[model samples]
Target: MDINLSLRHLRAFVAVADCGGYSAASRQVNLAQSALSRTIKEIEDELAVSLFDRTTRRVSLTAAGEQLLLNAREAIASFDGAFLRFQHYREGLSGTVSLAALSSVASILLPPVIFEFQSLRPNVRVSLEDGFAGEVVDSVMQGRVDFGITSLPRKKGRLICEKIAADTLTCICSSRHRFASKRSIEWRDIEGEDFVSFALSSSIFEVVEQGLRSADVSLGNITKARDIGTVAGLVSSDLGISVVPSLVLPMMQFCEYRGMPLSNPVVERNIYLIYDPETPMPPASTFLMDLLRRGPRSKFKIPNGVRWIDYPDGSCQANSN
Candidate 1:
C-alpha cells in the first residue's frame, strides 16, 4: 500500500462519509463527482482496504472507513497547522485572519487591534465583520470566521468562550433628550421614553429586558434595528434613547450623556473571544490568537474608562479605567 495518498484523497473520503454519498460529498467538498470518486478509489487502493461500503441509496463507513475518520480529522488538522507554522516562519509573520465582532466593538475596539496587529506583522491580512453579538458567536461556531468578539456570554457549550473584557452597559440619550440634564436616573426613569433597541433578535436586548422587567420597567415606542451603530445613529437623531455598552458611550458626543451605573441591579456584559474546539483554524488565525495572548492589553482609541473590578466570586469586574 502506498502512503503517498494526498490529503485531498482523505478529504474526499471523509466528505462522502459525512454527506451520505459520493454525489453529495462532491458538492460538500467542492470537487467534481468523477474527481471525488477517483480520489476515494486512490485512497482505498493505497490503504488496501475498502473504506466506504457504498450502495446506490446510501454510503456507509466500513471498518476501515470508521478507523480512518479519527485519523483523517487529526491528519487534516496537523496539515493545516503545519502550513500555518510554515507561513509563520517563512515571512516571519503571515496569514489572513478573519474576525467578526459586535457592532459596538467593531466601532471602538477593533481599530487599534487591527492597527497594532497589522503594524506588528506587516504580512498578515485581516478581514473584519460586524453584526449582532449572537451572529458573531454563530459565525465563530460555524467556522465561518476564525474569531468572534462579542459583549454577552449568554450561551454555553458548542464553542469555547473566554472573557476578554467586562464591558459596561450605559443608557444614552440625544442632546435634545428631555432627561439629558438629570444627574442620575433609576431603572424606571426611562421606561416610558421612546426607545431604539439593539434589535429584538439580539440576546443583549433580552438580557436588558429581563433587567427592566425585574425592576418593573417596560420599554416604549421601540424601534428595532440590527446593530448598535444603527441604534446609536437613531438615538443621535432624537429618534429615541437607547441602552448600549458603556465602551461606546465616548463615541456619542452629539448625543447627551450621563454615565450612571445601573443600580438596584447594575448591568455589565462580559465580552469574549469565541473559537471552536472541534474545528481547525488556519495559520493566520493561529498566529493572530497567539499575538493576542502575548500583546499588551488592547486599548480603544476612545476616552472611555474600563476599570477592573473583582467580582464577589473572585472573577474580575468590568472596570478597566
Candidate 2:
C-alpha cells in the first residue's frame, strides 16, 4: 500500500505512447518537452525496460510499452476520477439538489430561499416535491430526496432533525370576531368557538388538538380543510377561526385577525430540516443548508399585528438572506 509508484509516471508513459512522441505528449500533458522526455526516461528506468523505441525521425511503443499502456490508461482514469470527486466537494453551487417538502412550506418560505439559491448559483438545479409529514420523513430515510423540510420532531424515523425554524400556532379569525380586538388571548376563549381546521389526519389538526386538550377544553363541530391556504381563506371569510403556523400570516392577502400564545401550554412546532445520517448528502445540498442558516438579520417582528415567539434556531429568527 505504501509503494512509491505514482500516477505521474503512468500519465507520462501513456501520453508518450499514445501521442507517438515525447514532444506531442508534452503538449497533451501540459509539460515542457524536456520534462516529458525525462519523466518517460525515469519511468523506463523504474520498470527496468525500455518502453519506446526512439529514432531520429520517430518514436514508437515497444512490446513492454504497448502492454503497459492499458494499465497506465486505467490508472490515469482513476486518478482523474479522484480529482473530479474532490472538485464535487470543493464547489457545491454547480450541482443539482432535490428536496421533498411539506406543501405548507411551498406556500410561504421555501420559494424565496429556493429562488435566492438558484439566482446565486444558476448552475445548481433545485427541485422540490410535496408530501405530508410522514411521507416526507420516509422519503428522506429512503434517500428519495436529499432531505425533507417539514414540521420538526418527527415521532418515528431513523433521521436526524435539525430545527431550521420555529412556528407558533395562532387562532386566526375575521376582524369582526368578538375577541378580535384583544391584544392577548387564551385557549379558554376557544371553548365555545366552532373550528374550521385541517382533518384529524392532518399534522396541524394534531397540533391544534393537543393545544386545546392541554387547556382543558374541547373544540366543537370541527370542519376539515385540505390545505392551509384554504383554511386561512375560510378563517378570513369568518367560516370559523382556524389555527396555523405564524410564518403563514404575513403572506396572507386576506385581512384576518391573527394572534397567539394560547396561555394553556402553548404548543409550537419546530420546523426541521430532516436528513438521513446514513446517507451521504451531496455537496450542493450542504451548500443549500449553509444558506439556510440564521444570521444577525433575524429578529421578532409584528408583521400585520402578529408577533411570534421563536426559539433560538426557529424560522422567525432566521435571516431571510
Candidate 3:
C-alpha cells in the first residue's frame, strides 16, 4: 500500500470523527464545509475504506474510521508537541548557552545580567568559565565557549569583537602609599616605585607596557601575577602599587585600597564581547550577546560607590573628574 496521506488529511479526518459531522468540524478547523468534506473524502479514497456513514440527519464513524481515529489523534498531538518544542528553543526560552570571560568580568559584571536572564528564562541554562583574557579568547576560538568577555585581543583575524564598555585603568595601592591619598596620579610619579603587574600573556600587561613606554617610564622591581585576585592581594598588603581596570575593584576581595585614575595619556581598556563570526550563535547566546552589547553598566544597575565614567564617542579621554 502506498500511504500517500498528508497531515491535513489526518487532521480533517480526526476533526470529522470527533465533531460527528462535516459542518461542525469545518467550523472547528476553520475550513469551509465543502473543503472539509473533500479532505475527509481524500483520506478515505487513499486508504480505500469508508470512514463515515452519512445521512441527511446525522453522521457516524465506521469501524475503519474508529481505528484510524486513535492513530490520527496521536499523530496530530505529536506534530503539535514537536512544533511547540522548537518554538521554545527558537525564542531562547529553553536551551544552553556557554560563555568564557576574565575572572574579574565574570565575578563582578555578569551577576546582574545572568540573574535577570535566568529570571526571564528559567528553563534556559547558562554556563560560565573564568580565566585570563588570552585563555578566554582561546576558549571562544576553539569552540569551547560560545563567546567571551575580555579586553580586545591583539590579533583580530577570524574573530568578531564588539566593544561593550569603557574601563579605565586605575592605580591601586594601600592607604600607606603616598599617592594613595591623591585623587589622580601620573605615570611618571610611579616610574621608580615598586609595581605589581599581571603576567606577560595577559591583556592588562600589554596595555601597561604600552602606556609606560609612551610616557618614557619603566616599571621598577616588578612582581607578576597570573590572576587579578593575587594582584589585588599584593596591592592591599602594600607590597607594591599596581595599575588595573577600575571595573575590577568590585570583584576583588581586598579592602582599604584606593583607586586613582592614571594621567598623562590615561590608559583605558574597552571591554569586548568576542565570538567566532563563522559559526552561528545559539538563540539564547545571541540574546545574551545583544544584552551585553547595549552596555552592561547602562542597561543594568551598577553597584553603589562606583561612578560611571562616560567616554564620549570617538574620543579616548579617560582622566578622572
* lDDT-best of 1 and 3: 3
| TM values, all candidates | 0.60, 0.67, 0.84
lDDT of 2 at 110: 71
Model 3 / residue 253 / CA error / Å: 3.0
Task: Give the alpha carbon lDDT tens digit for every residue of 157-238 in model 2.
Answer: 5676666665677767778777677765788888878788887556677777778778887777777887666777777777
**Candidate 3 lDDT, 1-321, residue by residue in tens:** 679988888988888888888888999989999998888888888899999999997789999989999989899899999999899999998899999998877887788889888988899999999988888988988899899987877655678776666567778898888887798899888878889998998888988887889889976788999877788888888889998877777867456788887889887776777888787788999988866655534567654323333323322322221
Error of 2 at 314 (Å): 8.6
Best of the two (1, 2) by TM-score: 2
- How far in Å is the alpha carbon of 13 misplaced in model 2? 10
User: TM-score-based ranking, best first?
Assistant: 3, 2, 1
Clashes of each: 9, 4, 0
Error of 3 at 299 (Å): 4.3
Report the C-alpha displacement of residue 258, candidate 1, in angstroms. 6.2
Worst 10 residues of 3 by lDDT: 312-321
lDDT of 1 by residue, 1-321 (tens): 329978887788778888889788888999899998889888888888998787879989999899999899899999999998797856547767898987767777667667877787788778989888778877877778888877654553566665655565667777678767765567888778888887677756876776688789877798988755577678878888777667767566544444555556667666666777678677667666655443234443433444322223222322221
lDDT of each: 0.71, 0.71, 0.81
